[model samples]
Target: MDIVFTVLILLLAVSVSGIAIRLLPFSLPLPLVQIAIGAFLAWPALGLHVTFDPDIFMMLFIPPLLFADGWRIPKREFYMARRSILMLALGLVFMTVLAVGYFVHALVPAISLPVAFALAAVLSPTDAVALSGIVGKGKIPGRLMHILEGEALMNDASGLVALKFAIAAAMTGVFSLRDASISFVIIALGGLLVGAAVSWLFSFASTHLLNLNEEGDPAPGVVMTLLIPFAAYLIAERFELSGILAAVAAGMMMNYTSVANAGPASTRIRAGTTWSMIEFVFNGMVFILLGLQFPHILGRALLDAHETSDVQVGLLIGYIAAVAVALYAMRFVWVWLLRWFASRGATKHGVANAVPGLRTATVTTVAGVRGAVTLAGVLSLPEVLKNGAPLPGRDLAIFIASGVILVSLLVAVVTLPFLLHGWRKHKDPHAAEETLARTMAAQAAIRAIDDVHETESADLDESAAAYAADVTARVMDLYRRRLASLDDEQESRDLARRAESLEFTMKLAAMRAERKTLLALRNSRTINDETLNKLMREVDLSETALTARRK
Candidate 1:
C-alpha cells in the first residue's frame, strides 16, 4: 500500500509539474521545476520522503530513455558526427578521469586516488537531456545538437565502465591499466553486439512468430518494444558488458528494424503516443527523485560539516566549486583541441573561415551538465570493502558528487542562454532537402494514383469508367497542386498556395460542422455514444491532417 501510494504521488507530482511550469511568471527549465517541486514535497511539514536506490533507478529509467534517444536521432547525422562523438564520449571521458582524478586527489588529500578516479568517472558523462531542457528545441544548431546528443548517449557507458574499474581497484588495492583497457574494449563491443542482436531477434519474432504484419491489435508489439531496452540492459549486464551501451544500441537498432514500419498504422500511432508519455513521465520522475534526494544529501552533509567547524562547511562548498570548475576547464580544453585539429584539416582542404570559434567551444563546454547518471554512479559506490572496513571516502565523495551535480546544472542554467543568444538565426539548413523530398514524393504519389486509376478503369462500363476517370483526376490534382506549391516559379507557387489555403479553410469548416452535428446527435440521444465517437474521431483525424499540411 505504501509503495503504491508513493508511486501515485510521484505520478501526480509529474503531471502537476508539467502544468506548473507553464503557469509560472518566468520561464524555467522543466527539470529544475520538477526538482524544486520534489524538494518542496520533501520539506518537513509535507513529510514526503522516498529512498534513493541507485541500482534500481538506473535499471528502471536509464535504458528506455537512452533507447528512445537512439531510435529518434537521425542516423545520417549520427554517422557524420561519429568522429566528434567518439572523441568526446571515449577520449574526453578517459582524459577527464586521469586529469580530474589526480586533481581531485590533490585537492582533497584524504581521498584515495581510486576513489577520486571514481568521482571523475561519474562526473564525465554529461546530460544532454538537461541541456535540451535548458536550451529548448530549435535553439541549438542542428549539427552541434546531434553531436552533443550522440556524445551523451555513448559516454554513459564509458564513464560507468571506468567507475567499475575504479571501484574494483579501491576494493582490492590492485590496479591494471593494460587489463582495464583490454576489458573496456571487449565490454563495449560486446554490449553493442548484444543490443543489436536482441533488437534483431525481437524484429524477427514479431514478423515471423508473432505475425504483427497482419492486421490485429498492435498492443502486444508495442508492449514488446517497451521491454526491449530492459531486456537488452539486463542481458548485457548478465554477461558483464556495458548495459548502457546495450540499451543505446537496441534503440539505434530500432531505426533499421521493419517492426516499426511494417506494422499497422494504429500500432505506429499507439507506439509513438505510448513512448512519448513514457519519456515525459520517466524524465520528470528522475529529476524529481534527484530533487527529493538533494535536500537531504546537501543538508545532511553541510550540517555534519558545520557541527565539526564553520571552516569545514566552507571547505566542502569550496571543494564542490573547485571540482565543478576543473570539469568545465577540462571539457573546454579538450573540445577546443578537437575543433582546432578539425579546423587545420579543413583549411588544408581549402575551406574558408575554418578556424574554431570561442562561442561554439564554450557552448559545448557549458552544455556538459551532470545529471541522473552521475548521481546514480556516485551513489552506487560500495560503502564497505572486502575486509568489511568502511570505504574511506564514500560519504565525502557522495557529498561532492551531489554538490557538483547541482553546481553544473546551476552554471549551465545561468550561462547557456547568454552564450546561445542569436546563435543559428539563419534559415534552416535542411530546407532544400525537405523541399526536394516533398516534390519527389508528390510526383511519385501522382504516378501511383494514375497507375491504379488505369487498372480500375480497364474493364469498366462507359459510365463507370467516366466516373473513375473523374475520381482519379480529383485525387491526382491534389498532388499536382502540392507539386505546384513547391515549384521554383514564384507566380505558380503563389497561386497554388492560395488555392491550398482556401481549400484548407473549407475543409476545416466542414470538419467543425461534422463534429458539431455528431455532438448534437449524441446530446439528443439520436446517436449512441459509440457511433458519435467513431464519427467524431474521423472528423478529428481529418482536421488534424488538414492543419498539419497547412503548417
Candidate 2:
C-alpha cells in the first residue's frame, strides 16, 4: 500500500510536468517524454518498482477513454466523413490483420498463423488518445481532424473484435471462417443495440428528473452521466457482445437523443464540465499508465530476445512495422479512391460538389500512432502456451509492437505539424469551416449584445431599461447594416456561423430559465434531490449532445 501510494504520487507529478512541458513551443511528444521518465525511474540507480493489473488496464482505462471520445465525436461530421471512416475502421483493420499475420508466419515458421494473427490484430488500429494528443497539437483543419478522430474512435472496436476472434482461434486450436464472420456480426450489432438502448434510457430518465435550483441536486445526475458508458459496456460484454461498440452506440444515442431534448444553457454548462472532467481523468490515467508500463514491457522483451535468434528478432520487427505501414498505406489509398469517386459525381454536379483535396487524406494517414491499448494487448499475450509448453516468439512479438508504437508516434508528432501547415496554406474555405467549428460555442459579441439587451425589463426599472434599449438599438442598427453590406459567400458564411452560434446560446438560455423555475419549486420542498438530479443530468446530456453536433 505504501509503495502504491508513493508510485501514484510520483506518476501524478510526472503527468503534471509532462502537460506543462507540452504547452511549451519546443516540439516534443508528451507520451514519449513520459515514457522516458518511466525508463529513468526504472534505471538501476533510481530503482523504482511499480505494477499494474492487466484486468485493471482493460477495465479502468479502455472503456471511459473510448466512451469519452465516442461521446464527444460530432454526429454530423461523422456522417459526412462516413465513407472514409468506414474504410479506415473496417477495411483497414481487416487488411492489416491479414497482411501482418501472413508476413509474421512467413518470416518465422515457428509460430502458428492464428497466434501471429492475434499479434497482428493487436497492432491493427492507431491509438485514439495518442492521435488526439498529437493531432490536436497540430494546426490541422477541422474536417480532416474529425475524420481522423472518427476513424480512431470507431476502429478501436473493430480492432478489438478482430483480436477476440484471433485469440479464440489461437487458444482453442481451431477456427471457422463462417463462424467467425457470424460472431463478429453478432458482437458488433449486439453492442450497437445495447449501447443505443442504454444511453436512450438514461437520457430519458435524466430529462424528467432534473430540478435546477435545489442545493446538492445536481450530484446524482453527474454520477449517472459517468455511469452510462461503463453500464453500456458491461451489459454488452456480459452477453458476449462488443463492449466497445456498446459504449460507442451509447455515446451516439446520448448525443442525438439527449441533445435534441435538452435545455440549451444549463445543459451545455453541465455537459461541458462533465466532459472536461472525464477527459482529464481518463487522459491522465491513460498516459500515466503508458509511461509506467514501459520498463516492464522492455524488460520482458529483452528477456525474450535472449533466447530468440537475431533473424527472428528482425522478422518480428519487420512484421509489426509492416502492419503499421499497411494501416497507413491503406488510409492513403482508401481516401484517394473515395475522393476519386466523389470527384466523378462532382463532375456532373461540379467539382465544388466533391470532397476536399488529397492533402487531407495524406494528413490522416500520417496521424496513425499506436499507444496504450496496443501495448496492453501485446503485454497480455501469455508467456506460456497450453500443456505447459513455451510460447514461441512472445518476447519478439512484444518488441515488434513496441517498435511499431514508438515509430508511429515519432512520425506523427514530428511530421503532422508540417503536413497541417501545408494544408492550412492551401486551405479550402468550405472544408476549413466544417473542420474548425467549435463544439460548445458561445454567441458572437454582436449577437450576444443584441439578445441580452432585448430581454431587459422595461417595467421593472425604466431608467435601466431605457439605457439598455438605447444601447441595443445602436448596436443592432450598426451591425445589421454592416453585415448586410457583405455580399461574398465567405462573408455570408461568417455571418451565418454567428447566427448559428446566437441560436444555440438562445436555446441554452431558455432551457436554463425553465430549469430555474423547476428548481425553485423543488426548493420549496416539493421534490426530492434524486429526481431533480436525474432531470438535470438529462438536460446536461441533451446540451452536450447538441453542442457536439455543431462542432
Residue lDDT tens for model 2, 56-167? 6776667777777777787888898898788878888888788878877776666678777877888777776677667564366677677778877777778888877877
Best by lDDT: 1
Tell me each candidate's TM-score: 0.98, 0.74
lDDT of model 2 at position 502: 82
Over the stretch 95-168, how does candidate 1's per-residue lDDT look in tens digits? Answer: 99999999999999888999999999999999999889888998889999999999999999999999999999
lDDT of prediction 2 = 0.71
Clashing pairs in 2: 142-435, 143-435, 209-535, 210-535, 210-536, 211-532, 258-542, 259-542, 264-508, 265-508
Candidate 2 lDDT score at position 440: 13
Model 1, C-alpha of 223: deviation from truth (Å): 1.0
TM-score of 2: 0.74
User: What is the Cα-based TM-score of model 1?
Assistant: 0.98
Q: Which runs of model 1 end up more than 4 angstroms from their true locations?
A: none
Query: Candidate 2: which stretches are off by over 4 Å?
Result: 3-7, 22-25, 44-47, 210-216, 258-267, 303-361, 383-386, 424-551
Prediction-by-prediction clash tally: 0, 10
Count of clashes in candidate 2: 10
